[model samples]
Target: MLPSTYRDLLRTPGAAAFFLTAAVGRVGIAMTSLGIVWLVHGRTGSYALAGLVAGGFAVAEAVAGPQLGRLIDRYGQGRVLPPVLAAHAASVLALLVLVAEGRPGWLMAAAGAAAGASIPQLGALSAARWSALLRDGRAAELPSGFALESLANGLAYLAGPVLVSAVGAGGRPEVGSVLAAGLVVGGGLALAAQRRTAPPPAVTGPRTARSKASAAVGPRAGRSLVRPGFVVLAGLNLAIGVFFGAMQVSVAAFAVEHGVPGAAAPLYAASSCGGLLTGWLYGLRRWRAAPRVQLVVGTAALALGCVPLLVAGSLPGMGVSVALTGMAVPPILVVATVLTEATVHRHVLTQAFTWLNSASAAGSAVAAAASGQAVDAFGAHGGIAIAAAATTAMAALAAAGSRTFGPPAAKRGGGFGSSAPKRGGNFGRSGGV
Candidate 1:
């Protein structure tokens, strides 16, 4: 079933109204945080620099993400959010001030880093709350919510970069900063409006072995935050990250290197949004087949699709190559999403999501910077090759981990879901049976 009904997402629970309120805030925060890319690029006149700044933001968020999720799990959102929001506001304001003050590139990078680090827990925290509000069995709601969030992500990809480029071209990076600041402010206000609506947080003190094992979960899954199925999922994600990061940098860098730098934004936006349009349905597939099968095949298909890029000769070819590449992304992301939601405990679900998301960020930060520099030295195809190598390495890891990664152990307090490689929609395990 679809996660929350369309009406349900709009409705507020008696005590969890805050979740709905926070959703709006999340949208604003995402929209505006991204707006800074155009702003910063307009100021610096370097796409690589813009990417670095954005990568810094993503890196800080990725590094701190698991820790932040832990914080939310350890403390109530009420206790955690306000101060972080305040600090976030201050940091962004500092960034704005520097922009206005005409700060040097290094100074801008430093300010962006601080702001990115302090950007509060808007998206991550909001997701946690959404799951919580669905506690009274709106389970379908959560997945749909996620799908909608995914769709929203697509919208942001389309709008944020385009909007920033438009405004930046008007000769004002400050405009982008101002737009980011305004969204932050509005998001804060929206979240404040949600104070009374959110569900109580589900964090309990860390579950010790016996106590946790006593629950309905398998013994292994009951203990570590990691689970067997989740390992497979995360493992696949690790490779997927290399693919995603490499693609991002490759597109941007290739566009510039190929003399169609202006084509970069639209090409990526089309690729992502177009793929996402398909992802929603992919998520809705009601796949009774094992996710392991889907995962391996998905990864291979994605990888194969990427191989076409070696021959991309024009702006149009670039777009086609990217769009085909996009086809691989959603299946992996959605399958991972399903596997994780199915296998993970509810209390730590947000943290699980956060951790998985962190993997991609970690990969992107490391790969984007490395690949960007690689292109400068090795040229576009060489960068592409390196990226392809990185991604293949990831796929190989998932394949190796497949032995241990299987269906959740059946016995009580057993282990993770079973992970036997199957046929058809296989993920990273190649086409093997």
Candidate 2:
């Protein structure tokens, strides 16, 4: 049975509709990311091109994220999300047409660039929306919501590819393309339903106001997203990213080298399973404990979890290491997320989220190449050890810099509820960055 908080919150205003809409839409977006690569790769017969295709999405997303987040903060999500998703959907369709029509690789890459740049900021917006909802509602349900959302996000990764693979087994190249489209439309509709539920725009207090102003004119200007606490978290996250990204490439390379490439699946599955369990469990942990406590513990555990990876010389061993390490991820991410919402002034919240997106992408981009090279130079054990060290260091840093993230603004404490925000598109209620 669903809990009282969730059921009650959804029943109010447009919150319920938005929640349903987002979940539905996310499923589609998730599939695009998970399965699109294999589909493109299978057709192109060039891993380099495939990598470029994949990298293009990351680059576009990373480069454009802050602007997208800013737009959401400035204009509201409903105004921006649809068109972006549509453009993305159209690009995927165009790419499929090009492939079917025998277009050159350059053409496909070009098409990919357009699609990638325009991909909706749905992930961040959805997260922010949830944060907004939680800040204004009952605090008890807040943790559970984050936990459920993380699990759902992971499930999207797990299921997107499996579903695509299952559908493709019937020998239809267009199957993946069609599935991607269906998901886009479905997700788009779901997102649309939740439009009314967006919390009132966060109003910037003097601190954020001064920060924003200084960002425009001062020596340290132009980085409105870099709040001190946010900086600490982001810095730590970058290290974490390096660790995870390196592991992602290195793990695959290690398995393939050992002639047991299939073994990677078990480790990956174990990680996801652990993430699923931890996400849900953390919700029951009670939100009253200091956010930093959660942040520190989660990150420390995560770093420690990576320690096992250093000793794993085989598939089963790797799976155990991976699962244990995976346990630390959801909590770290969820804690960071909740903190970002709770602390950063509302006006700049979206920007902070985008900065995070950029961090993840940048980290992945660096890791993809560096990890492979490290493994080549030092062997898998060396590479894994390095990954663990970096991850642990990040956790320690987050612990040291924990003080910057203050308690939530009193007005912003619970998040949005069943009541429609009094000022539609006002973008001034919660507070700005």
Candidate 3:
């Protein structure tokens, strides 16, 4: 049964439309990387070139995400998404055409890069909308909203690979790319159509004399990346990304090493199931712990969870360990979303969220390469070791920056349901940085 909070949230005007559409759009985003890899490899018969092209796509998306998010924040979704989605569609078509013609690998990679650079950050944008909708007295619903978003992401991840792989197995890998492209454009446009729910663009007009005077007196504010606590959050998420990348490779390698290569998918699915279950449950209750404290504990738990992976000699044992590890991920992400919403300026909230996504993408790309090397040099256990090391670094980073994260709701004299002051609401600690 759905929780009342989730039911109530979906009942909000335009909520169901945007959420449903964004969920659809994210499935496309999830499909693109694997689709590209399959298409390229099938066409060219070179895993090396396929991986390079796919890696370039990921790196381009990570590089472009924050800048695109900043534009979305400044111009609003209605004004920005249409053109961006159009470009994405066009670039994807170009990629397909280039591949069909047996074009040079570099040309195909460039086309993939263009497609990736324009992929919308739908999940982050949806999160920003939830923040705007659930503000004031409805703040308690924020966690549930974020949890639903995380679940949507998980579902998309699961569906995308299956869909792409199934199509590829039928001997037309390019069809998967086409399907992903269509979904990305269609879902993005659907979300953009929900203009009523879109957050207002940040006011970037000329500063008034009084505001200018204050700005002159205070430290000059820059982008969200430079914000005090935000850097720590981004760093922690990067490490979490490393854990994800390493864990994926390690589990697959372990399964193959034990002569049960087919077991890899089910084992990873176990981790996903654990994450979805915990994320759903985590959103159901309001915790008294500070966001910072939750983050610290979450990272610590994740670190401990990864430790078991290093020692698991059997598939069943590894499944249990991976599931435990997956259980820790969603809560950390939920807390990170809560904290980002609380601390970032409302104007740049979407961009702030994108920065975290970008960080994770960057980390994942790096870890995938590093873990591949480790797996080659020292076998499956080496990859597991890398996963554990990443989580430990994440925990250490969380502990070090614990102080910068603001006090708990109790200290602030309010709980999750409490409203912020109207003038400079808790939405952004703009001056606190």
Candidate with top TM-score is 3
Candidate 3 lDDT, tens digit per residue, 35-146?
Answer: 9999999888999888878877888898898888888877689889999999999998998888889999999889989998999899988887787677657765677788
Candidate 1 displacement at residue 409 in angstroms: 11
Tens digits of per-residue lDDT, candidate 2, 298-397, equal 7888777777688777777887888888887887777776666655555566767777767876876787677778888887766676678778788888
TM-score of 2: 0.83
lDDT per model vs. reference = 0.58, 0.65, 0.80
Residue-level lDDT for 212 in candidate 1: 43
Candidate 1 vs candidate 2: the lDDT winner is 2
| Candidate 3 steric clashes | 0
Please tell me which model should have the higher lDDT, number 1 or number 3.
3
Model 3 misses residue 324 by how many Å?
0.7
Which 10-residue window in model 1 sums to the lowest lDDT?
Answer: 424-433
Candidate 1: TM-score?
0.75
- How many Å off is the CA of 306 in candidate 1? 1.8
TM-score of each: 0.75, 0.83, 0.90
- Ranked by TM-score, the better of candidates 2 and 3 is 3
Per-prediction tally of clashes: 30, 26, 0
